[model samples]
Target: MSVRKILVPLAGRAEDVEVLTTALSVSRAFEAQLVVLFTRPDPTEALPYLGDGVSGQVIEDLMQAAREGADQASGRVKSALTKIAGDAGVPLAEKGGEVKLPSVRFLDVTGRRDEVVAAHSRLSDLIVFGEGTTGVAGGTALEAAMMSAGRPVLIAPQKSWNPVGGSVCIGWDDSAEAAHAVTAAIPFLEEAKKVTILCVGGKELDPGPGSTLADYLELHGVVADVHLVDAAGRAAGEVLLEQAEAAKTDLLVMGGYSHSRLREFIIGGVTQHIRSHATIPVLMAH
Candidate 1:
C-alpha cells in the first residue's frame, strides 16, 4: 500500500529528535504527511485511580501538578518539532492542506497517550517509533498500534539517516507473519533502488524460499537479490542484523511475531532483539 500519512507519537523527550528525523526521512521518500502526535495526560482521568480517601485539597494539588507537567511537556515537544522541521527544511503547520513534501503537523490531544495514539493511527498508512519506545508506556502504544490499528510500525534507531527506504532488505522466513510484512512493505520495495531478500536456514525447504519471494517481487516490477545465509547456530536476529548492516540497508522489513500469555502480549524474542539492536529503521507488522 502507498504510504501517504505517517504517525509519530512524541512525549517531549530527548529521543523525540531522532524519531522525528527518522520519520522525516521517510516522509521525504514518499512525500507523505508526517503527523506528530502529542497526547497530554488528562489530569481528571487520574481522579478515579486516586480513590475516594483522598482529600479535596490533595486531589486539587495532584491535578494541578499533572496539568503543569503536561504544559511543560507540550512546550518542549513543540519547540523540538519547530527546530527539527526548520533544520530539515520541512514545513510545520497546525492544519493539513496543500503542502510540500515532508510537511508536518503537531497534534495535541488530552487523554491516555497510548490509546489516543492508537486511535489516531487507525487512519494513518504507517506509524514511526523510536527504538527506545519499546519501554512501558511506549510499548503499550506499540502494541495498541499493531493489535488495534493493524498498521505497519517503523522503529527508528537512536541515530538518524537520510533517504530512508533507499536500500531495502527483507527478512524472509516463509511464515504467514513474514508474508503480511512483505505485503505491507510493497511501497518501499517498489521504490527502493536495491532490494535484498535475506533467508536464514532456508536450505531445508522443498521450494527455495528466496526464489519464491524473488518471483513474487518480480510480479510487482521490483527486482530483488536473494541471499541465503546459514544461521550456524547463531540467533536469527544476530545473523539478520549482520547481513543488513553489511548491505548498509536503509530500511529492514520483517514480520513482528508475538504471543499471548496471561492475557498479555509479549513480543517474540527475535523481533525484540532486532528492535533493541538494529541500527537502521525496521518496518514490522503482527
Candidate 2:
C-alpha cells in the first residue's frame, strides 16, 4: 500500500520539530497529504467534585491554566509548521492539490489528547509521533493510534535526525504484524541504500526470516542483507536496537507487538519499548 496520508500529533513538547520534519519529509517523498493536530488537553477529565463549599475561583484558575497551555501549544505548532513548510517550499494551500510540495492542514481538536488523536487517526494512512511529551501522555497517544488507526505509526527519537531511509534495518519475526510492517514499508525499503533483515533467537531463525525477507525484497529489486543474532534473554526491542546501531541504519522497521486492553484498547510490549528507547526512527505496524 502507498503512504498517501500522514497524521502527526503535536503535544507542545520540545521534540515536535523532529517529528514534524520527519512527517513532512515522508510526505514529500511519497507525495502525501499531511494532517497535523495540537490536541487540547481536557481539564474537565480530572476536575473533581470539590464539594458544595468549593471555591469557584479555584475551579476558574484550573480551567484558565489548561486553556492557556493549549493556546500556547497551538501557537508553537502553527509557527513551527509554517517555518518548516516554507523551508520545504510547501505552499500554505487551503484545499490541498499542491503538486510540487505536500499539502498541509491542522485540526483544532478539544478532548483528552489521546482520545482526540485516536479518533482523528481513523482518517489517516499513517500516524507519525515524535518523542512523546516525555511521559505516558505520549505513550497513551501512541497506543491509541496503533490500536484504533489500523495502520502504521512512525515514532521518532528524542534527538534530531535526517533519516530519509537511505539505510534501513528490519526487526524480523514470523508474525502477522511483522509481515504487515514489511508490506507497509515497501516504499522506504525500495529506496534504501542498504537494507538488512535482522532475526534473533531460534524461533525467528527457524523459517530463516532473514533469507525469506531478503528473497522477498529481491523481487521488488531491493537488495537486502540478512543478519541473525542470539537473543540471549534480551528483549526483542533491545536486540533490534543493538543491531540497528551496529549497522548504523538510518531507520528501523518493525512490527508493533501488542495485546488488547479492555478488549478494545492496545498496550504494546516491544512496540512501546522501542518507541521509548530507540535512538533512531522506528516504523511500526500491527
Candidate 3:
C-alpha cells in the first residue's frame, strides 16, 4: 500500500522541527500530503484537581493561563510549520481539496492530547512521532497510535534529515509482530536502493528463518540480503542497531511492543531499547 497521507502530531516542543523535517522527507518521497496536527490539552482537566481552599477566581485564572499557554504554543508550532514547508517547497492546503503538488495542512484541536492524536491517526496512512520531551505524554501517544490507529508509525530520528527510505534495514525475529511490520513497510521496501534483513541471535530464527523472510520479500520484487548475527550475550537491540548503522541504513523497520509493555518496561526488551536509543528513522507496527 502507498503512503498517501502522513500525520505528524506536534506539541510545540524543541523537537518539532526535527519531526516536521522527517515527515516532509517521506512526503516528498511518496508525493503525499502532510497533516501537521497540534493538539492542546483541555484546560478544564485541571478543574477537578483544585483543592477545597481554592477560590473560584483562582480556578478561573488557572484555566485562563492554561488556555493562553496552549495558544502560544500553537502559534509557535504554526510558525515553524510555515517556515519548514516553504523551505521544502511544499504548498499548504486544506483538507479534502484537490491538489497536484505535494502539500501540507495544519490542524489545531483541543482535547486530551493522546486521544486526539489517536483519533486523527485512524484516518491517515502513516503516523510520524518525534522523541518527545521525557515524560508520560509521548509514550502515551505512541501506545495509543499503535494500539488504536492500526497504521504504521514512523519514529523520527534525533536529528532532522532528508532523503529517507533510500537504504533500509529490517529487524526480524519470526514473531507475528515482526511479520506485520514487514508487511506494513512494503512501500518503503519496494523503493529502497538497498535492503537488509538482520536476524539477531540464533534463537529468533528457529521458528522462521531469515531466508524465509527474504523469500517473502522477493515475492514483492524486493531483493534483500539476509544476515544472521550472533548476539553473544550482548543486548539484541544494541546488536541490531550497530549492524544497521554499519550497513548505512536510512530507515529501520521492525515490530514494536512485541511483548507486553509491562514486561518490556521491567526487564527491557528489544522494542524498548530501540525506542529509547535509535539514531535513525524507525518504522514500527504492532
Using TM-score as the measure, the top candidate is 3
TM-scores of the models, in the order given = 0.90, 0.88, 0.95
Please identify which of the two predictions, 1 or 2, would achieve the higher lDDT against the true structure. 1
Residue 278 miss distance in model 3 (angstroms):
0.8
Model 1 C-alpha lDDT per residue in residues 208-272, reported as the tens digit of each score: 88899999999999999998888887788888989998999999998876434222335356676
What is residue 137's positional error in candidate 2, in angstroms? 9.2
Where is model 3 poorest over a 10-residue stretch in terms of lDDT? Answer: 201-210
Q: Would you list the C-alpha lDDT of every candidate in the order shown?
A: 0.82, 0.78, 0.87
Per-residue lDDT of candidate 2, residues 127-243 (tens digit): 888766564324778878876667678876666556568899998877788888889899999889999888877444564667878888999999988877887887777788888
Cα-lDDT of candidate 1: 0.82
Report the error of model 3 at residue 78, Å. 0.9
- Each candidate's number of clashing pairs is 0, 0, 0
Error of 1 at 279 (Å): 1.9
List ranges where model 1 is wrong by over 4 Å.
Answer: 94-101, 133-138, 202-207, 258-268
C-alpha-based local distance difference test score of model 3? 0.87
TM-score of 2: 0.88
Candidate 3 per-residue lDDT over residues 98-178, each given as its tens digit: 784588999999998889989999988889988877632247788788877777788886888787879999999888888
